[model samples]
Target: MLKKGLYGIYKGVEFRITVDMDNNLKIMTDKKEKTDSTFEDTYQSGVYTKIVKPNELVDCVSVTPFGIIKGEKVQILQEKENKYQVATGALLVGSNLNLPRIDRDSWLGWVSKGEVKLFEEITPINPEDL
Candidate 1:
């Protein structure tokens, strides 16, 4: 089954992110531990989830909103019909860049093996800064 959360690393720190149907991203540390709190002393409760620093960001394409696909810097323009449109200044990585069944093994492999340096860092500008 596909995992609900994405495990990734931004800079050097590890993080897990969940994107809801509305595209709201919730980033937290990838680790979790049982807490002292419990429900009726039977069910575990209150697991700790850490949030990313406001200024820090991850580079993994699977988790990042911006990326270099087919050599062009692109941002996710739309998501429909189980496909995504990633565009870069009128150019696009084409529809194939985003697929309903992503090749998670290859993508995650690149992330884990530190092979992402071959692609340029193309994080999009946050409008809030302007």
Candidate 2:
């Protein structure tokens, strides 16, 4: 699990938006409970998989040494969650991890996402790169 105060970004499959995936991801949500007459139980909706760099972004430093950030975005890519959960939830959620700047566009946007293959065994990279 990621520590507190760490900013995270969303990354996952393309999730070709369609009835097939939408119906599937929708199942992940637990909205069975009825809401009060005033509002209604609609808060718990579209929750799905997320790819946090699995770590926290260190406090900003003056300059980056070298080879720290692969690019502007960082993704965990680790299967902290299960595949079935991913697919089905993808049906419901459409994306994962609601970090700062990570919106629906960013989640679907390729540039905002990361590579799962690379995150397989990623390690902490220091800004100084000793």
Candidate 3:
């Protein structure tokens, strides 16, 4: 049985497949939910990266309106053609100190492949320790 909140493609068109409370399969378009199907698991690891400088603005696929900032960290969720679906923090609504760090609150959107790069961590080494 097809799982709810998962994405699938049929007749070359992408769709968000969902199972209704009555167990009926419902296919919706242009809406991204929790896609956990193997068909959508194409990305290698949940690749996390930051938005490139001079941030390239692109229309987001979300229920709310917002803007992405340069250097903001995001997790690459899926990729289609030249675009990548990413998950990032939503707009700060209250005190920054009390911000919740959870997946349920993450903002999911799409970004061009050129607007992001794979993140790399660098560590300094002392000559004496070398």
Which candidate leads the pack in TM-score? Answer: 3
Query: What is candidate 2's CA lDDT for residue 60?
Result: 18
Q: Which candidate do you rate higher for TM-score, 1 or 2?
A: 1
Q: lDDT for every model? A: 0.37, 0.25, 0.40
Model 2 per-residue lDDT tens digits across residues 15-106: 11111233321111122232223222234453333211212224312221111123322333323332111111121233333323344433
Reference-based TM-score of each model: 0.25, 0.15, 0.29
For all candidates, the clash counts are: 0, 5, 0
For residue 31, give model 3's deviation from the true position in Å. 32
Between prediction 2 and prediction 3, the one with superior lDDT is 3
lDDT head-to-head 1 vs 3, winner: 3
lDDT of 1 by residue, 1-130 (tens): 1122255454575555444355544454323432122212223442334334435554533434544545544444434444444443341233344423234332111111121112233343331131
lDDT (0-100) at residue 112 of candidate 3? 71
List the candidate numbers ranked by TM-score, top first.
3, 1, 2
Question: What RMSD does each model have against the real structure?
Answer: 11.4, 18.4, 18.7
Clashing residue pairs, candidate 2? 21-91, 25-91, 25-92, 26-92, 35-41
lDDT of model 3, residue 53:
17
Quote the lDDT for 66 in model 3.
Answer: 24
lDDT of model 2 at residue 58?
A: 42
